[model samples]
Target: MVQQVQEVAQTGDNSGQDLVLSHVTKRFSDFVAVDDLSLTIPAGSFFALLGPSGCGKTTTLRMVAGLEQPSSGTISIGGRDVTSLPSHQREVNTVFQSYALFPHMSILDNVSFGLKRRRVRNPDAMAKEALEMVELGHLAARKPVQLSGGQQQRVALARALVNRPAVLLLDEPLGALDMKLRRQMQVELKAIQTDVGLTFIHVTHDQEEAMTMADTVAVMNKGRVEQMGDPRELYELPRTAFVANFLGKSNLMRGPITEDLGDAVAVDVSGVRVVLPKSRSAAHAGSAVVGVRPEKMRILDIDDAAYSPTANQLVGRVVDASFTGIITEYIVDVPGVGMVGTFSQNLGQRPAAPGERVRLLWEPEFSFGLPGDEEPAEGTDAV
Candidate 1:
């Protein structure tokens, strides 16, 4: 059966309301947290603000929830200007990592709190419906302390959704749960969002969480949006080294542009010539960095004879190999490319051992060029 959030019958359709931010910025004295940023979130979409610590993702979420005012920007929800509105007045709700449920209240009462505050008719029915949406209707009579972490999170979500807000802001709502439960909640949260038809703007530092749940992900850096698109697009065709490195692992090699093939470009990384298709090239005149995902490169015996001009091959010595049942991972030391990583599926073939000379081969199109050195920030990178 299809479940939906119990919006008031008179509220009508709200699928057309988009969240728009124009020239948004937030500064704290000498520090500028969120630089000039602009983005549009379509109505009823699952959007995510992803980044490392101090990247302004949380600050941006606060601005949207009316918890923090933007230094300079206009915020509108469903076509109404609410840049300066208070949190309670805006037609939005927030679910935090803490899952701040009242200890004294029963689950049913906790879920219905927002509705009762507004004096909605038949608050019990609406709260029960919201609980059902999260598959927690049976637990409504229990206290929050009696429920598990995942159960508590569902309650928090149910509370937020009971009022049928135009936008729902989630600030790392699953951060408190264990990794396994967190993954489980990610699926549940997405399903609830789909059933309810509400815009969900999520803020998370976990790359896997954002990639797993968000329909559109905006990667933020130093208070500015570095890139925004579908998760696969950002991962496969990262425009900046920060994005490429931050989103996931990438084998980046710095080199100079050796030739421009019109539809493709050749780069010399540590004396190794690499070809990349122009469609995905970020190659700049002089120097550039070529990025390829570890999974895209294959480890082959050095004796293989077949070679193609459109493919890149590097001779390297295996520095280390880790066999994790399903895949064999290798760290190879290429002469000009420094240390490179590759993953090969475990299909009965023996993995190369340390000290073995091997060949790393991949199609040219699997590589992407960036304009500069791969200088992703060190330490905890995302918020």
Candidate 2:
């Protein structure tokens, strides 16, 4: 199923696709926000434009929403060229981070506003059904300010979805919530998208959010998509160091060319040597960077180090340790590469203390390498 979708997306020009952006580029006076960006989102898929701020995730989304015109390239939704269409003309709706609700209007009224403006039949009934879809029917009488952040976000979702647009654009819709609420709403939003079978084109700077919600994740940098695939496909087999480091925590190692082992590019990173899963198409034997996620790395006691022969062990002195309930974060000092962190599940055993000598170990496949330390991405890398 995944392969079919991917093949169709890669080959399908404009037929039967929900959205397609070909060679999309956007720029301000001296800054290029999205450069030659191209992507296709399938119908009923939850797609995330994941990156840090200024990476053009939002800018790309704006182009899709008809809010921003790409300096070049075509933008299509439902096989229609909507690049130059006004936002109102596009069959897409956006749920903004600010909720964009009418504070004075009740929840049902808020949801019905768009339907009323479009003169949809039985606007009140549509609003009620939309509120029910979000499980907020009971609160439909309340005003925007009267609802919690989660509730307000639900109302915003209902408003956008009541019209049943072909695509739903979510631009950090939960960014304003507290941590706990944010996590809860992530599940809620995903559930809503699934239930409605709506194609969601969400943009966010949060890696975890993207991982949790997206069917396919696109990692962006400096106006270009660095890498993209399913979250696990990206996490377990990152094609580049940037994708590895950005998705989660990593102990990045850099080194000069040593050997090109057909499937893998072997190199010494500051004296430590480890073979990461190779992307034969992308690896080169130059200055290479390896990124290993912290959870994939284990902190072994000196006596236990020998037992971890399969683990790529790094020697370090525990500079700091913090018990984070679920896991303990340990900052360890490596000789030339500087400090790296490893996370230990707190439930396993009490965390090792600071100043203790330890070894961090992980399977060779846990890490990945790419062209080392290129110039930092300015307005395009993250946003």
Candidate 3:
């Protein structure tokens, strides 16, 4: 499949076609859907625009696809201004969530429709190769109704790939699939992007989907980017409370900065002094919100010998514990802190039950600090 796609890729040079959006903003009278957004997507990379609904990710994608014009600023592809160009004129194709395959047309004809419209020679052959690239050539004779949801999605993808656009836009293309199939498609879509070497800008609200398939992820919130970077980096060191809470579960400890230790800053959390690495902190002098992921914390008995004296520790009573196969999730409530969550790997030992007093400990370096003024509930509701 990969070799076949590479052969088709030789038909055109799709490399080095960077998609650049400069200070783009889109407004509908009173509502600003996308605000002063500027992004440079490198060629041949899989990038994801991730956010909750109405965060302007879809608006940004529409502007890139020429479906919606930006109220202001320029949209360019490969140094050429394409801001005013219609969707058809731009070197881009979009695979929508609806699949949009012609119900009556055979899969091969459906895939070949765009090529035929553009007067490309041997459209059927090209489309067949595309089907094979997606490993759907054997189903060419079937109609859309005859194929399953996952197969129909592949047909839609092949239809878009047959056009051989420099940039491909995926707008929640896997939203219709079940959980297991969605995960399967994520891997396949990433592999297809690598095989074709086309710049793919995926817009999705699913955090796992964005993190799994994209080489770079831009987390947008309320028409602006909260953070953008490699998925691992963004997860490890979130710059804002929204990113910390939205990307995954984070326990935020808000307090004043008591001292700066050159390499780390000390914050008093409910009378417990916790240290955060200076490089990981977005706040320096004023009060800060310290954050750590649930998986980074361990629930230990107060007298556990494994407890390190230097580690950040918070004592709390277990409110609830839910065992989910590989890991047990616990909700612990402390006197000063409202509620803190922890995930302990199930290693054939009994989990700490409810009402039991436990200590949550994590390495100080694992902590990240954000501005104290940022709302702790900013991105919690969206999840």
Residue pairs with backbone overlap in model 3: none
The CA lDDT of each predicted structure is: 0.87, 0.79, 0.92
- Residues 15-99 of candidate 3 have per-residue lDDT tens digits of 7789999999999999999999999999999999999999999999999999999999999999999999999999999999999
Of candidate 1, the 10-residue stretch with the lowest lDDT total is: 374-383
TM-score of each: 0.94, 0.88, 0.98
- What's the CA error at residue 131 for candidate 3, in Å? 0.3
Which lDDT value does model 2 have at 87? 92
lDDT of 1 by residue, 265-286 (tens): 8888776788998888866467
Selected candidate, larger lDDT, 1 vs 2: 1
Q: Ten consecutive residues with minimal summed lDDT in candidate 3?
A: 6-15
Better candidate number, 2 or 3, judged by lDDT? 3
Give per-residue CA lDDT, model 2, range 164-231, as digits (tens).
67788999998999999999999988877776666888899898999999999999988899889999
User: Highest lDDT: which candidate?
Assistant: 3
